[model samples]
Target: MDLTDTVAVVTGASSGIGEATAKALAREGCSVVLVARREDRLERIADEIESDRTLVIPTDVTDEDEVTAMVEETREVFGCLDILVNNAGVLRVDPVAEADMADFREQVEVNLLGAMNTTHAALPVMLESEHADIVTVSSVNARHPAKEGSAYTATKYGVNGFCRSLRKEMADEQVRVTIVMPGPVDSEMRDWENWEGRALEPTDVAESIAFAVSRPEHVEIPEITVSTTDKLR
Candidate 1:
């Protein structure tokens, strides 16, 4: 569908794929609502965009009230919500047996529960629109678990499952749901020692999201797995 004048809410928009996706959508004539904890960065990115139709909502996705407020504010500012991108995530690497349970809980809270919180808030708004889409950023680790990354893997795996079930429930509403699995993206979250060489750029993943949202109304791209050609197993 054409993104002209469509409204999109992007989580984790302070940097990385979320920031890139916000800019990409803006370039496509979509009015984007950028949600993140950093107000200064969000404003900076908003200023950088060419569109006059960007709203920066400083929000913590894990907070239900903030997420609900974000959804309400987006509707008030943009008039309609066409897309929701659940991209907020965190990673902690350690052997499952030796890792701190608190760290594991933190990862689960942000990666899994965070998405759920945002998605739950956005769903009602999306249902009221003519056509809507939900795109989630998952990791390849969801399917290919690493020895030292069990907690991270578990959260991603849970996100994948949650989106799948949500898609089935929303199918009749004409709300398209897509899950993107990217491998070793070159971001601040990656550790150089564990992940070396060229990794997928944040913009590359943003492009995937743009492509999925830009497809014809009758077309639904459910799942996309992207990895560096060199990293292919």
Candidate 2:
């Protein structure tokens, strides 16, 4: 809760974990910038923020130009960005042989490239800040792949790999990187599946994300894995 007045950008903030994380950040007194493709949803969420310091910028993180402009505009409004939450993602489930190329490509574009694009743009601003953090929303599937999860698994794996490498790259800088892997969160992404068991709520993962970044400046949590205990998956 030591983040009062700090600036944070949360992608995929229109719904699910991203939306929850934005609210959690705001509750911790962070000035949040909501980034996603849905302006109506973003505006609705922004209205609920108590700080009156939220910026809703409709963005497709898969596009580098949009991400670039997003960061630039965030700097213009907030002067600097202290935290970046790379939570924009999509899910595609099927065996590799049965996979549609379009679905696979879409997954990669949003889950993998979107995080990369946002991180690419935010790193420069983060480095200049007195203290900064980058928290990526991966999945437990990134480490434990499931059946019928070829494309989705691949993107989460890429997320895991990318964040690990970036953490090392930013180790010497004030900026720190953390990869958050959660399993079966109760969100639209999981609802698409015929998943019937209990699932972690979006707020669960959001709080985990908040805890990761709330650590003292001298302590950096590199990875966090949150999953349901009784899901019996």
- Segments in model 2 whose C-alpha atoms lie over 4 Å from true places: 191-196
For residues 1-233, could you state the per-residue lDDT of candidate 2 as single tens digits? 39998999999999999999999999999999999999999999998875689999999999999999999999999999999999999887887898899999999999999999999999999889999999999988877777788788899999999999988898789988999999898888983264566899999999999998899999999999998776535
Name the top lDDT candidate. Answer: 2
What lDDT tens digits, residue by residue, belong to model 1 across residues 32-139?
999999999999999999568999999998889999999999999888899999999888888778899999999998899999999998899899988889999999
Candidates in order, TM-scores: namely 0.96, 0.96
Listed per model in order, the count of residue pairs whose N, CA or C atoms clash below 3 Å is 1, 0
Lowest-sum lDDT 10-residue window in model 1: 188-197
Off by over 4 Å in 1: none
Prediction 1 global C-alpha lDDT: 0.90
